[model samples]
Target chain A: PSSGIEKPTVKRFESYKRDSQLPQAIGELRILVDYRAQSIILPIFGRPVPFHISTLKNASKNDEGNFVYLRLNFVSPGQIGGKKDELPFEDPNAQFIRSFTFRSSNNSRMSQVFKDIQDMKKAATKRETERKEFAD
Target chain B: MAAKTVQYDNIYLNLSEKPGKLRIAPSGLGWKSPSLAEPFTLPISEIRRFCWSRFARGYELKIILKSKDPVSLDGFSQEDLDDLINVIKQNFDMGIEQKEFSIKGWNWGEANFLGSELVFDVNSRPAFEIPISAVTNTNLSGKNEVALEFSTTDDKQIPSAQVDELVEMRLYVPGTTAKEDAADGEE
Candidate 1:
C-alpha cells in the first residue's frame, strides 16, 4: 500500500460527450413524465423507455416556444463498434448526450410540465447529496 | 363483455386525466388523454405500488410501475376514487402495496418511486435510489417534508438505472392542467 495514487475529484462534463443521431420519427414521439417518479418515459414504438431524472442534464422549451427539448447525458463504454470515439448505442458506460424535442399543440401544458421538471431537478440534487453523505 | 369505463373531464394534465375514458377490464387498464396522440395501456402484472391521497382540490391516485416511475392522476371525487380502487382489487392481481400519504406542497422535492426503490435528488449532489423495503421507517415533521430512516447494518446500495420496458398506460388529473391553460390565455 506504499505506492499509491489519489483519485480525481469533480469529473469534467466534456469527457462524457458521445455522438449519436436521433431518429427522424422522434419529433412526433411523446415523452411521458411521471412527476412523482422523477423520470422521463420515452414512448418508443414497441414500448416505453424510462430514463432516470439523473441522466437528464438540461430541459427547456425549444425556439418558438411550441415544444420541449431535453438533453440527456449518460456514460457508455469507451471502445465499441470497432471505433474509439463513437458511442454504439449499446455501450453501457458511454456518455451519450442526445437532445430530444417534443412538439405539442398546447404550449402551456407542455410549459407547465417542463416547469415541474425544473423544480424536480433542484430536489433531485438535494437527495443525491444526502445519499452521498450516508454512503461516506 | 366490454370493460368498465369511467370518464372525467378537465382533470389534471399531469395525471393525463383529461375528458377521456379510464377503461378497466380483465386484461388491464388504459387511459386516453386529450394531449396524447394515442391511448396508453398497462397490464395488471406490472404494477408494483399504489397510493391514494387528498390534494388541495381533490383525490390523487398514484400508480407505481415495477420498471418505471410512479404516476398520479387527480380530479376524482372521493367516492369514485374508492370505487376505482375496489374494482382494481376485485379483478386484478396488481401486486401493489398501498400506502397512506398526502404530499403537501412538494416539500421533499420530487421523490421517484421505481418499483421497490425510491429515488430523490437535491442540489449539488448525485441522485440515488434505495429500495423501499430497505427503508425502516418514514417520519413527517411539521416542516412539510418526510424524514426516512434506513438501516445501515445491511449496507444497501442505490440503483443507478431502471429496468427495461414500459407498458403503455395513461391517466391525468384536471387540477393543474386547467391552471396552466389559463396562464397561457392570459399571456
Candidate 2:
C-alpha cells in the first residue's frame, strides 16, 4: 500500500508579503535551498536566480511578535574600496554587496530557512575540504 | 610581449559606450574611453580578482583592483571574450610557479593550481591543497586586507611571521607596503 502511494511534493520556502514590501533589487522570489547544487535558488519573475553558498558571508534573525526579520549578507566580488578615477569619473566599490532584510511570517519558519542557509554553507566547506584531501 | 587590442561598447544598465578600447599588454591591462583623458593601466599585480558575468545584451568582464573600484567591461562578442580570458589566464600563469620564494623569509616552496586546488609545498613541511572556492577574496594592493587569508581553510594557522611573509609575497602592490614595512619588520 505504501509503495502504491505517490510521494508528497517538496515544499520550498515561500515569503509572505503581508505588511512589509519587497526590495526593488530582488523582486518576488520563491526561495529554494538546493543542497545538491550547494546554492540557494530564488525564482524571480520566472527567472531562476541562484546565489552560491560561499557568497553568503553572514546571517542573523530577529523575532518580533508574530514575524521574524531575517538579515542576510550578500557578498559579491565587485565591491572594491578605492579612490575616484583620476579624471573625475565614477568608481564603484568592489566588495560591498548590500545586506538584505526580509520579513517572514513566524519564528519557526524563519528559523528553518536560516538553518537551511547554514546547512548549505557547511556543505560548501565540506566539499572544499574533500577536494583538498583528494588532491593532497 | 604581444600587444593585442579589442574594441567594444561598455554597456551599463542605463548607459552606453561608443567603442572603447581594451589593450592587452604583457605586464598588465589597459582600458580607455572617449571621455577619459588617460587610458587606465592596471598592472597584473594590482588586479585583486576578475570574473565573467552575463548581461542583458551579452556578457561583462568584471575586474576588481586592490586599490581601486571595480570596473565592468561590457558588450563583448563571444570571440573577443574568449580571447580576453585567454590573455588574462596566460598572464596569471606567469605569476605562479613552484618552489618560488622571491620574497624574504616566507617560502612558497612549490605551489601549483592543480584543477581547482591550490597545492602548496612549503619546504620540509607537508604539502597541502587549498580549494579555490575557499578563498573569499584576495589582497592585491596590500593595504586594507592581507594578501591572502588562509582562515578560509580549516587547516591550522602557520606562525604569524610566516603569514606576514605570505602577505608580503602575494599582496604587496610595489609601493603601499612600504608604509607598513616598519611595523612588519619589527616582528
Candidate 3:
C-alpha cells in the first residue's frame, strides 16, 4: 500500500549577515519593509529585529479609535487551517513567534506597510509555485 | 578644580518622544530637554548598576537605580563607549556591563522570565526583551500556546510617531504537560 504523502523539505532564508548591514532607517524605530533584503525590520524595545519574508504567514491592518494597528502572523506549528504541505520549518518542535502586533497613529503608513508585506508574500509564493512546477 | 562633566547631545531619556542633552559629572547624571522646564537628575549615590548595549538609535546606556525603575538613555554612538566608560569609572566608581545582542533573524527562541522582563534569547544571546509591567493581558490561546497583549497607550510619554509600539505577542511553548490531575488517579 502506497501512502501518497511526501516529506516536506526545509526552507532556509537569511535576512542579514551583519548588524551593520541593516538599513539606516531602522534608527527611526519604525517597522521598515526592506524590499532589497526581502525582510521586514521591526523595532523591538530598542533593537531592530528582522523577519525574513519566507517566515511570514500574513499581515493585516485595521483602524481603531485614534490609532491603527498592524499585525504580522508568522508560520508556526499547530496551525489548523493551512495546507499540510505548507509547513515550512526545519524543526516543528522548535519554539516559534506566532504573531506580533504594532500600533501607530500613522494610519496611512501602516496601511502601506501592510500592503507591502502582502505583495512580498504573494511574490514569494508565486516564485515558489513556479519553482515547483518547473521541477515537476 | 572644577568637576569634569561629560556632556552628550541628542540623547533620548527613557525613549522619550524628543531627544535631549545628557551630562554626567561626579555629582550625578542630568538630562535636559528643550520642552522641559527643569532637568531630570539622578545622584551618583542612587545609581546601582548601568549597562551599555547597541540600540536602534545607535547605543543605549541603561542606568539601574537604587529605588526606582531603570532608566534608558539612547543615542550614543559606538565611539562614545570609551569616554562614557572612563567617565563612569572616574565619577561614579561603577563599571558598565556591555550587553551583546543576537542579530540572527530567527523567530524561534527560549522565552525566559527574568525579574520584571521577559527575555527572548536565541542561541543563548538575547534577541529582545519585553517589560513584564507593560503586558496588560495574557491568555492561553491554545494547547501549549500563550498570547500576551500589551498596553499601547502612551503612558510612558513616548510619542506614538517616534516608535512603533508593540501591542501584542503570541508564543508557542512545546512540552507543556496537560493538567494531569485527573490522570493521577488512574496512574
Candidate 4:
C-alpha cells in the first residue's frame, strides 16, 4: 500500500546570520516585513523577534473600533483540516510558537503588512510547487 | 573624586515610546524623558547584574535589580559597549555579561525557566525571553498546547496607544510521562 510519491523534506531557512544585519526600521517598534531577508520582524516587549517566511502559515488583519489587529499563524501539529505530513517541522516535539496576535492603531500600515505577508506566502508556495514539480 | 557620569542619548527605557537621556554614575542610573514629567532612577545598591545584548533597535543594557522587574535601555550603538562596560565596572564594581541572541529564526526551541524568565533557546542560543511576571493568564487550549496572555493594561512604562503590542502567545509543549510521574511521587 505504498504510494510512489515521496514526502517533501523540510527545508531550513534563516532570517539573519548576525544581529547587525537586522533592518534598521525595527527600531520603530512596529512590524516590519523584510522581503530580502524573507522574514517578518515583530517587536515583542521591545525586542525585535524574527519569524522566517517558511514558518508562517497565514496572516490576517482586521479592524476593531480604533485599532487594527494582525494575527500570524504558524505551522504546528494537531491542526484540524490540513494534511499532517504536508507541513513538516524541524522538530515536531520541540516547543513551537503557534501564533502571535499584535494590535496597532496604524490601520493603513497594518493593511499593507497583511498584503505583504500574503504576497510572500503566495510566492513561497509557488516556488515550493515548482520545486516539487521539478523533483518529480 | 566622584565617578564621572556617563550619558547616552536617544535611549529607550522600558520600551518607552520616546527616546530619553540615560546617565550612569556612581550614584546609579537615571533616565530622563521629555515625554514624562518624572525621571526614573535606579540606585547602585539595587543593582543585581547587567546584561548586554544586541537587540532590534541597537545595543541593549539590561539591568537586573534586587527585587524589582529588570530595566532595559535600548538604542546604544556598538561603540558604546566599551564605555558602558568601563563605567559600570569602575563605578558599580560589576561586570556586564554579553549575551548573544540567535538569529536563525526557528520557531522550535527548548523553553527553559531561568529564574524569573522563560527563555526560549534555539541551537543553544537564546531566541527570546519572557518574564514570568508579565504573563497574566495561562490555559491549556488543546492537547500539548498552552496559551499565555500578557498584561497590556498595567504597564506604565510603554504607552499602549502608541505602539503595536503583543497580546498573547501560544506554545506547544510535548508531554513527558516520566517527569510527571517523578513529580507526582515526590509530592
RMSD of each: 20.1, 19.8, 6.2, 4.4
Ranking by lDDT: 4, 3, 2, 1
DockQ, per-model, please? 0.02, 0.03, 0.63, 0.67
Give the TM-score comparing model 1 with the true structure, all chains together: 0.32
Comparing 3 with 4 on TM-score, the higher-scoring candidate is: 4
Candidate 4 displacement at residue B124 in angstroms: 1.4
* Candidate 2 lDDT tens digits, A32-90: 56564455544211122344565465677777786566666544322354223211111
Cα error, residue B138 of model 2, in Å, equals: 24
Among all candidates shown, the one with the greatest TM-score: 4
The global Cα lDDT (0 to 1) of model 2 is: 0.43
Best by lDDT: 4
TM-scores, one per candidate: 0.32, 0.30, 0.87, 0.90
Candidate 4 segments exceeding 4 Å error: A1-8, B153-162, B176-187
Model 1: per-residue lDDT, tens digit, B70-116? 55455556677656766667666333343333211111123345444
What's the ranking of the predictions by DockQ, best on top?
4, 3, 2, 1
> What is candidate 4's lDDT per residue for A1-136, written digit by digit as tens?
4378766667878999988789888878788899999898888777788998988888888899998989998877766665754757778878888889888878988999999999988998999889767866
lDDT of 3 by residue, A1-136 (tens): 3357755667777788777888999888899999888999988765688888888888888899989988898888887676767847676666789999998888888888888899989999999899877855
Q: Which pairs clash in model 4?
A: none
Sort by TM-score, best first: what order?
4, 3, 1, 2
lDDT of 4 by residue, B1-187 (tens): 2367888889988877778899998899999987777888999998889999987578899987776677888889989999887888889888999999888877888877665677789889988877778889888887787888987744485453237888888877787421211111111
Q: Which scores higher on lDDT, 1 or 4?
A: 4
Score candidate 2 by TM-score against the native.
0.30
